[model samples]
Target chain A: MNPFPASDYIVAAFFLFCIATTVGGAFVAILTARVIRSVCGLMICCVGLAGLYFFLNSPFLALMEILIYIGAVCVTIVFAVMLAEPDEPPSGQNHGPGVLWGVVALVVSAAICWGLSQLSLRGPWVAPAARVNDGSIKAIGVSLLTTYSMAFELISLVLLVAIVGALVIARTGRTKP
Target chain B: MSLPEPFRLLSFLVGVMAFVGFNAAYLVWVERKSAARFQRRPGPTEVGYAGLLQPIADGIKLLSKQLIVPPGADRILFMVAPLMVMIPAMISLVVLPFGGSLMARDINVGLLMMFAFGSINVMSIMLSGWSSRNKYAIISAARIVSQDVAYEIPMLLVVITLLMITGTMNLNEIVQQQEGWFWHWNLFRLNVNPLMPLTFLIFFTCMLAEINRAPFDMAEAESELVAGAFTEYAGMGFGVFFVAEYANIVVGCSFATVLFLGGWQSPFGLWSGVWWFLLKMYALVFTVIWVRWTFPRTQFYNLLNLSWQLLIPASLFTLILVAAMMKFL
Candidate 1:
């Protein structure tokens, strides 16, 4: 008898789809001509990342990935796009410098990607000796307050400073120097 | 439904979707009649009986309209945004605890999942408005981003306070905590603490803002922005947004019902089931419609001031107060 059912194949197919979506969305994000379309590409990539996170068994992180990236970050980028007229330069005029920059960028990205892939694939892949936490929301909350409390407080402080800095910068151009 | 199993979840999703569809249609009808009554004028009495079938007429009209793609608009994003909105609005309904056994997914982070998925609705609006290539739509989108950012803080604080009081994030667990008597509902936790009412009020207003209902509906102010982000959409492109808005309202009110009101729990310890859940949800929804017609649209600055100045401070205070109560009491 078949140990694995048709449902298992369906799930595997869905997982493959998620991988395709993530890679395709990222490719579109970098390759797109229109700045706004790039934002859409980023959003699609985020959604795919959510799927990946779901597969990783942290549905909380999956949802938060959608919430913070697509919801807050992309929307703010959209606002900036609206306020500041932006469009890709379309490989304007230069043949030599442009190609040079393109090669440099490509080389950098490829190296990083290859390095990370190797690091992941070459892992020992052994289970941890002991479990510190269950990775539930409760576990996350407890660790955030207990073990990671300092970092959590620092993050909040950073966000507060960023808001203040934004306001200060926004207010500067209006007042007479 | 337990969701380690996929086959059962697939069937349950199908049923839940049908229920959501019926809820959206019925809500549109209710909203129309409620608005007519508030205005002291007759509603669509010609369609079926007492305007019972007006939503069908509206649906037919929307469906029949031409789907025109404006030349300047981003073709793909314009097409995709409506579906984007419809997806998350429906997904959020999955985790909402309707009754003892009426939920689809009872994950521990139920309320957080709702909030997380709900944010995508705002993102979709941003995309649609940005893609439309209209100044009004762009402006509306910008306004919405700011409004969402401001209102979300107070709402999160309210949710956090509730999480502390109830000592759980699961919607089913939260609802179970409020069982037996109506007074046991978290809204009137006045016996243990005085901050619950304020938190509830904060939650209600934030819920209205989150779903883009009036008087907080300045982003879609019809007269000012010519229907705002929806100015360029036509036919079912617009229809999808309309359906999604009503669906979001239902989801928001359902959330409020579960969080504050005694969800599916009886007032007098009598009949209980999904019916009581439906009753509480609809009653909250009716109040949403009632408030929409009664209040005038708020000014944009005034709206920000209300959220940032009033609601934010009040909610933070409530959060602190509740924490203290939990510590000492």
Candidate 2:
């Protein structure tokens, strides 16, 4: 039984807030003309998605979402924007190929949306008979080190290669004195 | 009799809020007095005895002053940035175990959660700088991001070293493992990790950089960047930034206390309680303030080099050394 009767209402309100934040942030990301604002919008969307993950009983994933996306990815984007031009180029006119391209883009997005909603709504949503683990940090750690050990090592190897490649590229641009 | 669940949660939240508010106010006084002492001068002896009422007066002054947005600044982001900096640090206080059974929430991943919220701190600084529309602030923002990114690696490496030795991410559990004598503490657990003290040093160094304290305070290097990221903020906006900085110091020091110095555990094996926790935490804070007053602000390139070049390899070495010791010894 629930101790606080109003807790359900509170949870529902928070859920609604998360949904609103996600949708609102995505809109800002897409509709904003400034690149910096768009990056901020993306950060907000990631935060909202983290909240949604928390609601789905995955606090680990939620924390990782915030840690990786909002912390690392968004900050990197902001850093890049700071170093580069931060504003979008102005659209010249409402007429011409822009209007046609916009219409076609809208149609494509609508179709994708329709297809996704249909697929999700009609898909089987049965609960699994048994969970392999309780999804605690310990469980995740065990599985990571044991079952997914090879995959984990591969990912780390790939990341190391990427880092070295990045260093090489960055080094090439600077002339030796 | 125990309080109801909601009531218990509410009381804990309120208690943590009060504790944060008190620390934020008084820590400024502590720093001022300590800095004064280091310089051989009387600090604030004005408002009340030893300037006890100074923070209150300062708070009132900051609150009464006007919050101004520069002509070209982004209004919403500028207004939201200070609150953003303050809130996550406050949230982190909820999970910090003050004494036995004194934590607000005992989540399994409490350490990770604190760090997750802690990571959000850099974003707020970046936003404040970028939104201010000031060149100095923007430069400060850029420096903060790179500084955080560089130090976070060694910080995480050192943490992983401790985690491997302790076998848990829960702050309370980590403390529990270090129960009994001072030698049982992670800092002195040489039987497990021979480089335990060095590991703590790496973590402390990273923490100093992480919280933007002196020597690593490139985010607000006043001589260089004109008050750094919060240059355009006025009154309570600046006041909140000041409060958040102190609050973050408390959080970071508390984290170090928990991870290394043994949270709430008495060193002499006598009465163990919140007092010991506070004693250790404040000692770390004092060290931090002392460090600020003593060392000159480091060069930005040196700051990065310290992290990427020296600290990272050293921490990685400690991690492997600890692992091998655990495996064979």
Candidate 3:
């Protein structure tokens, strides 16, 4: 009587969709000539990455990825795009070294991508014997406070320094202009 | 045969869409009438009874008009902007509790989900501005992002302080924590923490800014900006943004109500249930409208200053104080 695929199949289909989004988004980001479109590509990649995070059983990380990256980072990139330039200027046609550099760059990137893929696909993979924790929000809170408290405080300190430095730099820029 | 799960979700989405459509239209009418009353002028009494049908007429007019995509606009991005604005506002409603077990989907990190979705509205707005390629739109968009980032810090701090007290991120659980007599509401958490009222005020101000409502609506200052980021958006593209704005307002109010106003908990024991929730939410929306008509918009620099200079430090103080009180008490 069932017309739709089972839940597992749906999950698998969605997983494939996420992978496609990630790969396609990366392609769009690099291949696009316009900087604004590239920014949009990054946003799409983040959204797909967030989907992958969701599938990994961490909704909080998924939401944070979207909230921070797409919401803050991408928007900042867009602002820079608007203020500076909308599109990358055309690279004038040059013959000898330009072709050489393009081929070399392509080869290096392809090799790196291939190596990473091979390493991931062929590496030793095994399921854990049993779960240690449910990985709920409360569990995360407790872990951060108890086990990872030092790292958390360090991050806060780092953020404080970054904010202060940004303010100083921005204020200086204001005075000169 | 349809999968029952998706079918249910589809129906829920349909219901929510209907609600959003009806609410947005009715709100504009409410706004017009309220503005009229303030100025002692009759408002839209022609369409149906007391201008009840005016929204439909406006909708028809908007739909009938030519959707002029501005010259040299980025075709795809320009069209997608309104969808970006509306979708998040729609998705956020899924986690909201209408009454007892009344939410479409009660995710664990419900409050965080709302904030995450709410943040996307600004991005959509920026995209709309840029795609149009208008100078005023670009300037308005610039103001929006800066204002958003400044106000968001205080908003998150206020939420952090609230979570510290309630000790959960689930909206339903938060409401349950504040259940009981009227005094037990988080707004009047006077006994537990005296700083809540101020937090509420700060949070509400940030909410007004976040939704780009008036006084804080620096992005849409009509006098200077020429309709701001939406200058080039015409027809239903513009209509979608308007609808999304009101939808966000409703969602923001519901979130506030759930957090601070004891959710659906009646002020008195006699008047209990979902009606109370509706009343409280509508009351907040009404206040937003009333404030819009009453006050002149703030200067952009002053708007940013209010968030950074005043609100951020105050919310930070409140957060620390609340934490200390939670520890000492």
- Candidate number of the best DockQ: 2
lDDT tens digits by residue: candidate 1, B27-119 = 888888889998998877998999898888888898999999899888899999899889887888889888898888888778888988898
Chain B: TM-scores of all predictions: 0.96, 0.99, 0.97
Best by lDDT: 2
lDDT of every model, 2 decimals: 0.85, 0.91, 0.87
Query: For every candidate, how close is chain A to the native chain A in TM-score?
Result: 0.83, 0.80, 0.75
Q: Give the poorly placed runs of model 3, Cα more than 4 Å off.
A: A1-5, A86-104, A126-136, A149-161, A174-177, B1-3, B269-271
Q: Backbone clashes in each candidate structure, one number apiece? A: 0, 0, 0
- Candidate 1 scores an iRMS of 4.4
Q: How far out, in Å, is residue B268 in model 1? A: 2.9
Instruction: Indicate the DockQ of the complex predicted as candidate 1.
Output: 0.47
Candidate 3, residues B245-318, lDDT tens digits: the string is: 89999999998999999888787655567888999999999999998999999988899889889999999999
Model 1, chain B only, scores a TM-score of 0.96
DockQ score for model 2: 0.57
Order of quality (DockQ): 2, 1, 3
- Model 2 Cα lDDT, one tens digit per residue, B198-244: 99999999999999999899999999899999999999999999999
CA lDDT, candidate 2, residue B310: 99
Better of 1 and 2 by lDDT: 2
Per-residue accuracy of model 1 over A1-177 as CA lDDT, tens digit each:
223357779888999888888988898899887888888888888888899888877777788898789877887787788678745356656788889999999999999999999988997786433444555556888989999999999999999999999999999899985
